[model samples]
Target chain A: MTLDFWGLGLQAVNVLILVWLLTRVFWRPVAAAIVARQTAAQALLSDAEGTQAKADAALAEVTKAREEIAAERAAMLASAAQEAEVAVQAKMAEARAKAEALVEAAKVAQGHAAEAARKEQTRQAATLAVEIAGKLLARLDPNAVQGAFLAQLVAAVEGLPEQDRAALTRGGTLVSAAALDDAGQARIAEALGKMPGLTFVVDPALIAGFVLRTQHVVLHDSWQSDLDHILKDLRHAA
Target chain B: MNSPLDAVALFQIGPVPITQAILTTWGIMAVLLLGAFALTRRLTLTPGRRQAALELIVTTMDTQIRETTGAEPAPYRGFIGTLFLFILVANWSSLIPGLDPPTAQLETDAALAVLVFLSVIWFGVQGGGVAGYLRSFASPNVVMIPLNMLESVTRVFSMFVRLFGNVMSGVFVIGIVASLAGLLVPIPLMALDLLTGLVQAYIFAVLAMVFISATVEDGTPKSQKET
Candidate 1:
């Protein structure tokens, strides 16, 4: 075999040129594109992660706010309930006080009404008694009635205390329910007029007996006064 | 009969002589350059069919380079891929009538081996530094330094002889059979020659890879070096 050194040298140079050309034309750009794509994909993933983190944070904040609002609402509801209870209690107390006051007023009015009714009953009894006495006296003999009354007057005058008798003996007036005869008047004047200025007054209100009133003393022995005392005792016992 | 020993001188350029093998080599280079230009014209991040195919080819070669050398394939990809493509295309060109394959010539095979030899040194120095590469010759013992040195030269020579002998014999056998059997009978031989041509191209590329890796690895055992 013939060895051509010049041909070998040219072929080597040709191979070197082809190798340099192919590296420049093809391999470098393709590799660069691949690396760039990988970098871009990584960047996109990082951005997605950041967005997810932000979303999680915002959700947590919202949850916290909701919990706070719920607590506030609960507090307000409790306070409202307390205020409602207080207002209800106050209304109940006021109503109870008003009821007690109404009861007290009714009791006072009932007492007053009872007192008035008793007074009216006593007045009616006294009038009926006076009417019956007057009828009975009209049926009796005048001399006999005057005699009985004179005896009672003398007895009542003698029963008085010494000081009251002395005061009565001073100038005084005698009031009686019935007109008296001259003898009867003379008897009464003699019984009561130890001092002088003795006068007699006929008063229909003193139904059956006399009332002697002196400047310092008064003595009443009348049906109306006796009935009024009896009625007062009855009220006291009740 | 076309003598496989001699490269036919086709023309000359001033003092530099141009031959048929050089012309054929130029044509191959032009076709490769034009194809690369067309494929890369509108490269997109999203690839179409043609770009996909191109990427597959590039990636396959890169993987091979990485596997063979146990190094980053980037620097080695261009030279290794170019050698494989040129030899493969040159050997297959024999299918065309009246056109001799460039690899069938002694000069082309020698030139390929020379480039491989030079690349081995370049990569070795780049990996190990010149000093370390020189020191590797004295490995296993300084007494074997001469034998190791002779082994490097002979290996490169064997690469040249192996490729040239296989391709030239294929062509010569096909030619002799075509003449003796009057055309139709030589078809089987031609088909067999196609297989032989492909196998020879693969052997040439693989040997070149082994030689370059051996220098870079420096003190690897003989079995690992073969792998």
Candidate 2:
């Protein structure tokens, strides 16, 4: 309306006082609350971001640990396999050595058995020949001049060639008083044939002693050839 | 001629007929105050039937202040609300049979303009500092310094003239029309007068809010310079 200068001034003063009172009473707390609300919201957002970052870091750490454990497990498994292979190889080598030793022991035992069997066969042959010669000697004469004549003949034959003398020396002569049968003489002749240049002769005074002679040498004794042959075979077998 | 409205005779004070349009204006103010006081005596936050009408007016003003100032309505609530209520009452006062709108006079409009001018300077000084208040005129550029200073002076004058001219023209036109036509024919013209009165009042309050907001800014040209 139409207020004069004084009235208008008073109205202006009234408006100013009213505005001041309203601002002080009503607006201050509302403004403060708004600012506080904004600040709290910002703080809460930052805290959420920080917590999310921590969770991500923890997840990454957990993943890293799992990977490391997996790698360690793989390494352990590989090491175990390698150790198992080494153990298997060692056992194989030990078994190979044991098998080789067993084969060598079997060879040695086989060689010993073969040598003993040869010696036993030689001994049995000598004993049978000696017994045969002893029986023949008992049937021969006890005493006679002829026997002394025979001894003289044998001494003459002992002076023979060295090649023929070695052959007669390998098997000493066995003398028998009994006459040889056809088969027995044939066996004696065949044995003498294996020793060439040696002769087998029997004297009655010698009693079953057979003399093995060459042109210049004679070997005389009962069962002497059998014993000498047996001794020679035994030395060869050993 | 004959003077159409016989303005000197029809408008008067008690024994002295005011040649300056003062008596008609005071009568309007008195009536408006009486009516407003009658409408809202026992004020309530929730509002009864009669109080609800008053609350609607206050709320409309509150919304306008909040939109224009871009600040909480609570901060400048009282000033904006009072300005709106006072202007509304003054404008509506002209609807009475024998009353003239007081705001139609140069003296009354200039007084309201001066109030706005003073409030702008006062709030500016209070918002920042003396230095900050002076710096508001120097903004945009150093070249704008003189222009800004002149603008502040011109703004008060513009406020004064706009409200004065608009209200006075409406009254003058209506008075002329009433003289030409008879009483019965002037009814529509009187309705138009009511609309114009409300518009002028709203313009004055809105312009006052704009001035107050401009002055209250921090006056730091760093932001304007960046733009």
lDDT of 1 by residue, A47-141 (tens): 98899899899999999999999999999999999999999999999999999999999999998898888777766665666567656655666
The most accurate candidate by lDDT is 1
10 residues in a row with least lDDT, candidate 2 chain A = A22-31
Task: Write the residue-wise lDDT of candidate 2 on A78-123 in tens digits.
Answer: 9999999999999999998998888888888887887678667666
Q: How good is the docking of model 2, by CAPRI class? A: incorrect
For model 1, name the residue pairs that clash: none
Q: TM for chain B in all models? A: 0.89, 0.78
Name the weakest run of 10 consecutive residues (lDDT summed) in model 1 chain B: B216-225
Fnat for candidate 1 (0 to 1): 0.57
Task: Supply DockQ values for each candidate.
Answer: 0.40, 0.06
Kindly state the fnat score of candidate 2: 0.09
TM-score of chain A of 1: 0.51
Q: Mind giving the per-residue lDDT tens digits that candidate 2 earns over B13-111?
A: 354335333454444335544555565444434347765555555556667888897755665666665565556556666667666665665555666
The candidate maximizing DockQ is: 1
Each candidate's clash count = 0, 16
